[model samples]
Target: MGRILLAVVALLLPAHAQEWRLTRSQSLTQEGTRAWRYTLSPADRAGRELWQKLVLQYQDHLRAGYRVDLGSWRLYFLGGRLRLEPHCPQVNPACFTFGALPVEKGVQDRFLLGLSQLLDQALAQARNTGGNLTLSGLFRVELKPGQAPPYLARPSGWAP
Candidate 1:
């Protein structure tokens, strides 16, 4: 296990340095307008090495509506995702969106909290590791920016 972990960590490091911040986060507005945003965070210390894992994220949401009358509102659904990361992989690369959240929504960012449930199908075991081409959460944005963020890990022996 240690050898595999060392090899993986070594593979993660490249000649160029990587940014360790989250950005391009978006949300909804009260007037029914779309609001896009982002956040950046970094830590500098030499305590627990694991505590210094760099994390970058991007999230976007769109919500548009017209209130011709209060009784009923008009909403046209048109929302997807666009992410770009020249420094790192689009996804966390090491993160596997499986298992369950260890903590509740502690921070204000709450858009992608429940989104994990949408990817629960990937949690099932198949005939082989690569038996099926599971999405494996490569397409799911499962957490929003907040004080209580989602776990960067999974339970002991879970594979997806």
Candidate 2:
């Protein structure tokens, strides 16, 4: 029957092919450096793999657009045994090794572009998994030169 075939196909699909969400984020401006951290829910191997290749190989593309005033920055992510961290000496004092990608100054565009691609991958996975896409709401990041990024301490989402 048609329903039986559909059920069988669903059973063969991967879990990540169903949905992705932004589960957590950590932003820090420590020792004169800034870093924002976020993890995707339902992490997928394919998504991580794509980031490894695209981010690691983005140097040439990034060098073409590098600007000194933008300051140095790095974006990193783990892909299986491989880790991709874009280098930016002008901005980042030293790279952080934790499982995060730092976007140093001047590379905001690339960071956004990269995030969009990753999100697209998540969307596609949802389609493949026979699940509807769900978007995580926007989050605000408060930045200071030498302080931990502020977060909403109360339910109203106000920072004191």
Candidate 3:
């Protein structure tokens, strides 16, 4: 739903890109029906975008899923963020088709998270070989001050 995406966006984005070090971390939690998480530490804009794509995709599968005999099914790829309505061949309802929605550009913090969720949903629907899927590593974006034309000061002897 649009509200779900909006709520996640509003609840996550931060307005300070100057100080802290951006961190990208993921944790896997297996509970009632295996739940996992992939997120960025010191997270920023890009991460959020990735997460958004994932959530919309996850929802698409859930909405479009239908079991003819209650077990076998066909999984549909719902692109990125869900639009006004999605249409799947199996499901006639407009909502079934998670259309092409406007994904926020600079939301990096949550992007990976969304991406992870999407992958998980895909794995679930996909009857292929999939068990140990991972999105691992530290992601960083730096913004440091550069030396000026006049105020440039050379390193005054290296200090420990």
Where in model 1 is the C-alpha error above 4 Å? 1-10, 14-19, 43-160
Task: Sort the candidates on TM-score, descending order.
Answer: 2, 3, 1
How do the residues 1-160 of candidate 2 rate in per-residue lDDT, one tens digit apiece?
9677546533533332333345433335556533333333324565455445433334333334421111122321222111122244322212222113454432333333334444444334433332222222211222233322111211111111
lDDT of 3 by residue, 51-156 (tens): 3554345444444642111001122223421121112222111212232446543333233233323433333422132122222221111111331111111111
TM-score of 2: 0.24
Indicate which candidate wins on TM-score. Answer: 2
RMSD of 1: 20.1
Q: Which candidate is the best by lDDT?
A: 2
Measured on C-alpha atoms, candidate 3 has an lDDT of: 0.29
The predicted structure with the larger lDDT, 1 or 3, is 3
Q: Could you tell me how far off, in angstroms, the CA of residue 97 lies in candidate 1 after the best superposition?
A: 35
